[model samples]
Structures are given as C-alpha cells and as structure tokens.
Target: MATDDGMRLAYYIVLLVVIGGAMLFELSGRGGKALRQLVLWVVIFAGAAFAAELWMNDGLGGRQTITSEGRIEIPASRDGHFHLTARLNGTDVRFIVDTGASSIALGPADARRIGIDPDDLAYVGSAMTANGQVQTAPVTIDELAIGDIVDRNVRAWVIDGELDGSLLGMSYLRTFARVSFENDLLVLER
Candidate 1:
C-alpha cells in the first residue's frame, strides 16, 4: 500500500475503535445511564455512519454492481473517492469518478494499458492540478464501459506525471441519463 493510504487506514481504524469502545463502556452501566447511553449510542452510530459514508464515497473497492433496477451502484472508498472499474479499449482500467474534472484523465501507465503509447504522444495540452500545472496528451478511448453503461470515442487526456490512477471525469459521466448519490451509493442510470 502507498504510504498515504496506509496512514489514512490507520487513522480511521483508531477513530472507530476509540468511539466504539467508549459507546460500549457507556452502555454497560444502568440507572442514570438511560439518556446518557442513548446519546452515547447516537454519537457512536453517527461516527460509524460517518465512516461508512467516507468508505462508500472513496470507492476503494473499485467494484461497480448492478442493482435490481438495472442501475449501476458504486460504493465509496475509505478515503472518500468514488472508485470504479471501467473497461477502456476492452481492458479493465480503474478510475476514480471525479466530478471536478472537466474530462477523462488517464495516467501514463493507464494510457499504455488502453493501447496508447505515451512516448509517441505530444503533451501539447496543460491542466492545473493540486500539484500545480502538468502537461497532458489528448487521447481517445474506443470503448469505455462501467457496468452496462458504455461510451465510444470518449475524449480524454494522458497525464505526463505519475498518476495514482485514471479519473472518470465529465467526458464519460455526462453521458449518463441521471447520476445521483443516495444511501451511500453512487447511482448511475442510463
């Protein structure tokens, strides 16, 4: 695991354990404990629910499951990113669904995975990232699919720097008939 990811995991684990233990201790006693216990449980449950929200939002599992209604649902990751697996050019590429991004972004490695030779591409475009300005190369995905959803000839950029993973940006997400998040599920209906 990356150092950043490891640290985040440790942080959450400690937070949940501490909160849970406190809740249990509060529940063990009786008498004046009624309201206290209730409040404590509420706090504990809220903590857990918050953790769940972060997990589902992170999409660390990178798995998208089809619902009974034929919509796509992606649970969040621990770090609160909606990670999903998309088939790019018939090969599986893991992507973080990023609404903030204007278009799809593929890392150098992911560009190669989708059959683009990074070395041959000209990084004529630029995008501002959290790390500052970075060069980008325009590319196209012949096929990008998440669950049963599919888009062809999708426009994207290849990041010149080392990217943790590809980002599923508006270029593809906009194709969805409806996109919403409900009950911790990133719902996409076509």
Candidate 2:
C-alpha cells in the first residue's frame, strides 16, 4: 500500500513536470513548424513515460524493474504472505496468503460463490479461529486463480459455521517458487 502511494506521488510529480515543460514549449518563440514539432514530441514523451509505468505494474516490465529500487513505488514484491486480489472462476476473490492455516479454509459465502452446496458437506472437525472454535467441512474449490495463475480441484475446508473469510493457507502458498513482500507489493515467482 505504501509503495502504491509512493508511486502515485512520483507519477503526480512527473505529471507536474510534464505540464511545466509543455507550458515552456508553448512559450518558446520559434513560430511555425519548429514549435509545433517540438510540442508534438513532448506529448509523445509524456505518453511513453506513463505507459511504461503501466507495463511495469502488469509484470511485463521484467524482473529488472521488479528488483530495481525507486523504479516505481510498486510495493517490493519480495517475500511475504500477501493479500493479492486473485481471480477465481472469472470472479475476484480475496485470500490471505497464510502459512499458518493447516488446510485451505473457505467461508460459507465463498463456498456458495464457488458452486459448492453448503448443506451437502459434512462437518468434520473443529478448527480454531481468532475468535474461537468453528466447525469445518471438507470441500474443494473447482477452480482457483490469481492473476494469470490458476489451479483446479484445490482442496479446502468450508467452515460449517461462521467464518470471517477464506484462507489461502500453506497448502497453496507452498506451490509458488518464491513468495515475498517488499514495498507493499506481494511478489510471487513461480
């Protein structure tokens, strides 16, 4: 989050500079083609600069930019359990990349959203929660995805009773080659 804010600030500063440069170009007295040509070039430069930032965020900017310091406040995707906005069956789902959770756990709502029939599953165990004990049932996510990442027939538990949300426990996090957190960006390398 901090990294994102830093990037926003940096971009804003860049925008201010671009505007100032444009104003200066407009004032540069060379009358006809020369001034118009210079103005066009400036616009092109600004557009390219912003486009590059977007590219970097999309992970297409390459590993060099990911590891580069001060390239963009794109939270260091270093090493940590990150809360990445993941895709699941073409829908967005929030998951906590937790290493502590014994098995993947899903909330009742999430289970329903994923096409699981809550009444059909059997409550097998009592899982401990931050609030207290909760019943857990065996369930499988037909499809689980994150960005371009996807996994099918993933094992997870549907807490029989109330649960705050689902957990992307070690079972899932372990599959990645590397999981890191730096600059507020959860970087996953697989």
Candidate 3:
C-alpha cells in the first residue's frame, strides 16, 4: 500500500536498503564524497561486528570483570574460595573444590597440556583412590584459573599416564579457604 520512487524494494526488505540508500546519495552528489564516506562506514561497521563476536566467545572475555585496569576482583565468593571460570593449561575445564587431595591431580590430557613428561615424574608416592591405591607422578602446572582468578607456579600430579588428565587436588585448592559449590558454579571466598 505504498508508492516507490522507482528504486528496487527487495533491497529495502532485507536490510540491503542501507547500501542502496548510500549509493543513491553518493550518486546524487557530483563530487561522490558521500558515497566514499558510506563505503568507509560500512567496512568499519563490519569489522567491529566481527571483533565483538570474537571477544565475547574467546577465553579472555569470558572471565574478565571490570573491577579495574587489567584486574578482575572476585565479588566475594560463597565460601572462603572465589568461584569462577577455570582453565587447565589453556584448555577449557570445569573443577570442584576437593580438600581431600594432597596434591593437584591432572587428567591424562591435562597433564600433557601442562607439558608434564610422563617419564620425568614417576609414581614415587601413593595416594588413595576411590577403588584403591593408585600410582602417581609429580608434575607442575604452568597456570591455573578460577573464572578470572589466576594462580601460577602451581604444583600438580600426573595420573592415568596411559589415559591422560588430572584432578584439581589440595595442592591447588588449598590456596583458598572452604571452597563452595553451588548449582554449576564454584566460588573461592579467599
């Protein structure tokens, strides 16, 4: 129920209308300055859209909180520990607070990600497992994260050597007091 100025209406229906409008305005100008500006704006907008998408999906964006410049403060977790997103050796991971473990246990794959050579750390010590006594190896993790919380120079132990990965044992959990688990989140109140 409308009249047109001979411009294609299909473009208007699907948001290509902006491009058409830009072109029309550009053509109307003898100097073509408007067209150049429109094109520049379109390019800039597209780039910004891509960048925003990447930032939102990336690891850095997931945990970063605007507490201050380059610092993310925990908003006082439930227990003594602050619950936040955690990554093991750059790999996305989920962990629960377990004070029972004497040292950090790495899933077979997690151990490899931390660059723990299976041969270097042998099963010198024994730790109790749900099933029974299990062999273990000594290793260290390059980094550990709980949400935006960062803990470095952490000690970890290798497990399931042939299988790969470890458990987030006391070695890493002891840093905080009384870890809390609620729903699908963990909070370290320290």
Task: State which candidate, 2 or 3, has the greater lDDT.
Answer: 2
Query: On residues 1-190, what C-alpha lDDT tens digit does candidate 1 reach at each position?
Result: 6464698678668777767766666767644767667668767776887668565554355557876565888877667777787789878888889999989999988889879999999999999887889999998789877656677898999999978788888877888789999877798887
List pairs with backbone clashes in candidate 2.
Answer: 75-183, 76-182, 76-183, 78-180, 78-181, 79-180, 79-181, 80-180, 80-181
Better of 1 and 3 by TM-score: 1
What's the lDDT for all of these models? Answer: 0.80, 0.66, 0.54
lDDT of 3 by residue, 45-118 (tens): 75565557445434222332423222333332333433233676776554433557677776666565556666
RMSD, one per candidate, in order: 9.3, 10.4, 13.9
Ranking, lDDT, top scorer first = 1, 2, 3
Clashes of each: 10, 9, 25
**lDDT at residue 4 of model 3 (Cα atoms):** 25
Lowest summed-lDDT stretch of 10 residues in model 2? 64-73
Residue runs of model 1 more than 4 Å from their true location after superposition: 1-62, 68-70
- Please list all clashing residue pairs in model 1, or write none if there are none: 55-76, 56-76, 57-76, 57-80, 58-77, 58-80, 58-81, 59-76, 59-77, 60-77
In model 3, what is the error at residue 114, expressed in angstroms?
A: 2.9
TM-score, ranked from best to worst: 1, 2, 3
**Tens-digit lDDT string for candidate 2 (1-190):** 3465588778868877876777676678556877767776877788787677656454332222232221211233333334445555655666666768878888888778777777888898788888789888887676776534668988888887777667878787777777666655555666
